[model samples]
Every structure is written in C-alpha cells, then in structure tokens.
Target: MVNLSVATFGGGCFWCIEAVVQHLKGIEALKSGFSGGFIKNPPYREVCTGRTGHAEVIQVSFNPDIISYHDLILIFMTSHDPTTLNRQGGDKGTQYRSIILYHDDTQKEIAEQVFEEVTSLYEDPLVTELKPFEVFYNAEEDHQNYFNNNQDTPYCEIVIDPKIQKLKKMYADKLA
Candidate 1:
C-alpha cells in the first residue's frame, strides 16, 4: 500500500478549499475542520464569530507518489488569493485567513520555500501564515462535503464554481 501524507491548509472557507482539492489525484481523504484555534472542539457558530481563533481548514490525505506535496501547495496557492490577509473573497476575519499548517520540519521548510516562490508572482506580499500543525476540530457534519452537497446554492455558484473551473484549467493533468 502507498503511504499517505497529510497536509492541512486554511485558504478560505473549508467548503471551497475542500471542494477543489478533493478532486486531485492521489488524495485519499479530505476533512473540513477548524485549526490554529485556542478553544477545544470549536463549533461552526463559534468559529464563524472569529473569536475561537480557528481558521476554517481542510486536512488533506494524499499519496506523495502520485502527487507531491509541493504540487498540492502550488495548486492551493493558485486556487485562492494568498495576498489577502485574513480574508478570501467575501469571507472575512481570522476564520478565513490564508494559512498552511505543516506537519513536520520538512513540511515547514518546504512550505517556506513554496511561499517565497509564490510571493514573487504577485505584486502584494503573500500573507499566508506558515504554522505548525495543531489540533484540528472537525467541523460539524453539515459542513463536510459542503460544496458537493450545495453546488446549486447561490454562494457556491458565485464563489466556488469559478475556483473549480480555475483548478481544472490550471491543473488538468492532476485531476483524479
């Protein structure tokens, strides 16, 4: 069996990130969750208030042999705007901040390098925080697979559909 690696990212709403990344090849599983927070087991309502210090993140499990972590990070950076601080589109506050939670020293180093490389592509500095992986509170059941379940919703059509299209166009070779 192939060994799977985990990468956690908070680029915006977990729904949007989860929807896009789950389509990539080698991704074994994806969970919508809250992380980098101070509270224990923060619920969606608390997280939405932005007081829990938790960012809506998705923990992605993937096989490195098929899709390297570097590739995943590149796709993530492109899928969302990393230059915006604590925000993605209409989502605002700390709960929607752009962040990458590394699982180890190697991941940290790689994340730093990737951030630097991606930074030069934009006129504004990249604000995506590179932090150590901490507790991940699984978002409530209603939040999981949100995009797939609510694709017809107005929010999904306006905010998430474009992201999916962009992913397909940019990483056609990486799709599962």
Candidate 2:
C-alpha cells in the first residue's frame, strides 16, 4: 500500500530482530534471512556453525513517512549490542555479527551517522559492519515468524521472548 522499500539488519538472532522491527508501525514486512555471509544459499543449519560469514538478519520494508531512517536506526542501535564484534549475548561468531545492509547512499549515510552517535556514547569501537545490499537468501520456513510460532520453545523462551518483551516495553510508541 505504501511506497516502502527495505532495510536489512543483523544484530544476532533473526527471530529477535524480526519481532522488534515487525512491531514498528511503518514496517510493512519482515523477512527473516541470512546476510553478510560468504556461503551461497545458506540454510539455518549452515549458519549456526559460525563458519559462514553470514549473520541472522531481517529484511525490513518500511514507510519513511511513518518511520524515518533515523528512528529505525535508533531502534536498531538499542535492540542489540553494537559494541560487540561478531557476537551478541550467547550467540557468537560471524553468524551473529552486527550489520546493516544498506540499499543506497542515503541508507549508508544514515547508518554511519547513527553508528557514530552510538559509538560516541559507548567506549568500545562500534563493530557493526555496514555492508552494501547484495543478496538476501530467505531463511528456512521454520525460521520465519519464529517468535510467534515457537515462543514456548526453549530458544524462543530463553532468547527471543525477552527480546520481544524488551522491544514492546521500550519501543511501544513505534509499534504498529
């Protein structure tokens, strides 16, 4: 309906990121997938090994009028640890690396500015990698909308649910 496009991000778990971004009002769709990785056509199993350069990411399509890039970037910065290089909480390795897959210079510029502002607040060098949008391979069907389907599951219970709660409490104003 809206002239929305995409913003792909990898903060650790795709499910968690998907949960948070999908709650945002402007986001039209959220596609849990793999990005910033080396393997071609990587699956969920392959990405878990930490060998693949890829990270669990969500491709977000959003309307700029409702949610500016700056706002989205802020949500992204708060949703995960940008200071952590190649990891987030218990998830470690390249598969968990923080990344922003920018489609154009505008996205890249906004991301860089946001990263700078965030990095200035924290002591560690923000390790979030800003990569050009290449290709996004959809994750397994089981992985899509995982938080909603698998909330009772251990990984979701232990990892994603809290993230969902956090997003809901912290960013309720942005919710759809």
Predicted structure 1: lDDT: 0.93
Clashing pairs in 1: none
What are the per-residue Cα lDDT tens digits for candidate 2 across 1-176? Answer: 56887898889888888877877898878899998878899989998998778889989888999999888988898888889988889988888888999999999999988887777777788888888999899999988988888778898888877777888898888888
Top-TM-score structure, candidate number: 1
Output the number of the lDDT-best candidate. 1
Model 2: which ten-residue window has the lowest total lDDT? 115-124
lDDT of 1 by residue, 45-133 (tens): 99999999999999999999999999999999989999999999999999999999999999988888788778878999999988899
TM-score, candidate number 1: 0.98
> In model 2, which runs have C-alpha deviations exceeding 4 angstroms?
none
Backbone collision tally, model 1: 0
